[model samples]
Target: MRRSGVVRGWRLVALVAAALAIAVVGVLAARAVLDAPALRDFFSRYPGTTERPEAAPYGFPAWLQWQHFLNAFLLVFIVKSGLQIRAKQRPPAFVTRRNTGLITTKRPPRRLGLHVWWHLVVDTLWVLNGVIYFVLLFASGQWLRLVPLTWDVIPNAISAGIQYAAFQWPLHDGWVHYNALQQLFYAATVFLAGPLALVTGLRLSPIFTQRDSWFTRRFTETAARRLHWAIMVYFLAFTVVHVTLVVTTGALRNLNAMYAGRHDESWIGLAIFAVSLVVMVLGWFVARPALLTRLAERGNDVRRMK
Candidate 1:
């Protein structure tokens, strides 16, 4: 039976609530066990340090601040539209006239055409932003801050994990230093997850299907789709944990660094963050299928003209 939109919405809410409840229970249990003498000894033995080579100055530049904002903005739209596309359950609204010969298994609803269009559009923007970020990061030599240079990072990351489990936050000076765990996570997000997402997305595109090559054979559409979904899950989990730590550990200082490009603990950054958040929320409301369809049609027109 086809469920009403309200019923589906409630189901989503229930699922999210269940997940949060499980997370809370898991955290409490971990905390109860994390402080045991054996575990404490193990953590102390590691005693991780945040040492890095040729570290840049511990301050956010104007460019970095703007990049951060753009990344967050693009990510929000990408994730939202991506989810909408995934939720589709009937045939595509329109099919290409060209015979690309790509398999189409799932029949998505007509409305999903808009979702897919928005997802692709925002994904392109996100990739461009990432490219710019990479160039500037390496050029400025700030990549050292995220990419670990030593094998000790593994053990140190474990120690950092223990600290987090015990509710004792690690020292965080993001402008200057990040704990071993933070460094590893950031490195994975940048060098691994980001590239994997882009590659998997491209693999699903018609452009890849049009060209028969060893690359396409190795990364089949099915594999690409599954990996893309997994990447989305990873991003969602990372965002949740990252935000929780940011707010719980030190909101003011973190906000100051990212938003205001300052080290001081002030409300200015928080205010700016709040305004930015409002804009994002407003965007979320206005990003309807009708608007997306119009945008997608315009894009198609431009492509044909080209």
Candidate 2:
């Protein structure tokens, strides 16, 4: 017989508990090993962070705070709507594109599920925000802070990873520079994973699929679908680890730098962070099918799929 929902939920909880216990024990064992004389000497030699270029940027700018907030806000909705689209195979309502632009002559009106329409809308906003972020990141010379400038970063990143795994996170001032591990992860998230998601998502989108070409035939829809799902999982995992580290390492200082654009130990950053969380939670609940169908019907023809 198939397992009931309650039984499955309990099983998931037990599985998560077991994983956490294993992780704790593993970290303790690694800590004991790293405390040995040989490893201690290695740690002393490499430390956890390499020296950054003299021209590297410092301090979180006000624009960065706004960008951070917008990115987070859009991401919450994007992920929520994306998951909704994925889970609900037969969308309750469908939306046919409204043709009005000059480009509409090239491509006819296309029909899509209401959930998919929501995902696409949020994703477009996220991409636009990312474009603005990239422009500012380069214009302000903040790219130097995230992209590694030397080969020494490899060893330093490894050292930082060791430190993190051993329950000894590297100490660094975020207002000035991030440790090697943080720098590398940030770079990968921004450049590599972000583009991967965009590319894969586009491959599965109506604009690309509506046309037939060598590229479309080679990159199958099934592959794009699977890769897109994997990218989402990667993003979710990254967010969990990033938030945990931010809170555990230096919650107040980090929050202040990112949210309030200040370097003080005040509680303003925490307050802002709490407010952002509330907004995200409200967005999660407010994005229901009933509300979405009504909103989507304003511009496009929305119909309940019989």
Candidate 3:
């Protein structure tokens, strides 16, 4: 189960043979479509023919807005809290730890513009982002697609990794199934990062900061800062991996579908796009019971396979 034909040093070169086959087939397919008047007419009717698709349902636009707000929040909080906490250090060992590790010990914290008012501004955005994210999870059923329900998930993920790395795929599932890393990442973002950011931010707030609330309130502000930084690092890394995966596999085909909401298999792309619709209307409908049943069935299937 652990072994796969895709990931290795020489397999990349070995895969040249298969790549050539694929390229030839692709060229032929392109020419056939190009020469056929019917195909041209059909594509004319569907300008997004395997090239462009829409991803409106992903809430990419709204998410982008939220990201902007988050960046502003981070900037305000980091700067305002930085000046206040840095330099001389404080009662909590973290102030020293943060400055020493993240910043060189050579310099003191900047005192300029270090004020309480800006701190409050930072806290407000943290609260606002918490509220927005809670609503986003409910409004968007994106939670369903990313979570791993089956025990087979881990093995499958590793298998997918090996195959991809070896430059071959042993199991060509109809859908481009997610590997383990993707599932783990998506789940972590949904369940861990969002909540942690909120809790840590609030805990650092002077209004609610307290020794008794150290676990959640007045929690290690430095640790929270570290966590926030880590999340951004993860986000940046994921973006690179995601783009690289799309390109290595097939950029134009997948990107077109994501952008315009149409792909080679129109319905599949539509269904994925429809995830956004489900997000918006998930709670209002009475279909929760049936959805639960379907989830249960899927769960049972996984167990059976195991």
Ranking by lDDT: 2, 1, 3
User: Poorest 10 consecutive residues of model 2 by lDDT?
Assistant: 100-109
What's model 3's overall lDDT? 0.47
- Tens digit of per-residue lDDT, candidate 1, span 59-170: 7788888888888888888888788767874423432322224633343212225456567778888999899999999988878888889898898887778668757776
Best candidate per TM-score, number?
Answer: 2
- The number of the candidate with the highest lDDT is 2
Query: What are the models' TM-scores?
Result: 0.79, 0.91, 0.42
lDDT of 3 by residue, 55-88 (tens): 2133233463444335443544444344454443
lDDT of 2 by residue, 10-78 (tens): 999999999999999989877876688878877787787878778988888988888888888888888
RMSD after Cα superposition, model 3: 20.8
The global C-alpha lDDT for each of the candidates, from Candidate 1 onward, is 0.77, 0.87, 0.47
Number of colliding residue pairs in each model: 5, 0, 19
Ranking by TM-score: 2, 1, 3
Give candidate 3 regions above 4 Å deviation.
Answer: 1-141, 169-180, 207-218, 264-306
Cα RMSD for candidates in order? 7.0, 2.7, 20.8
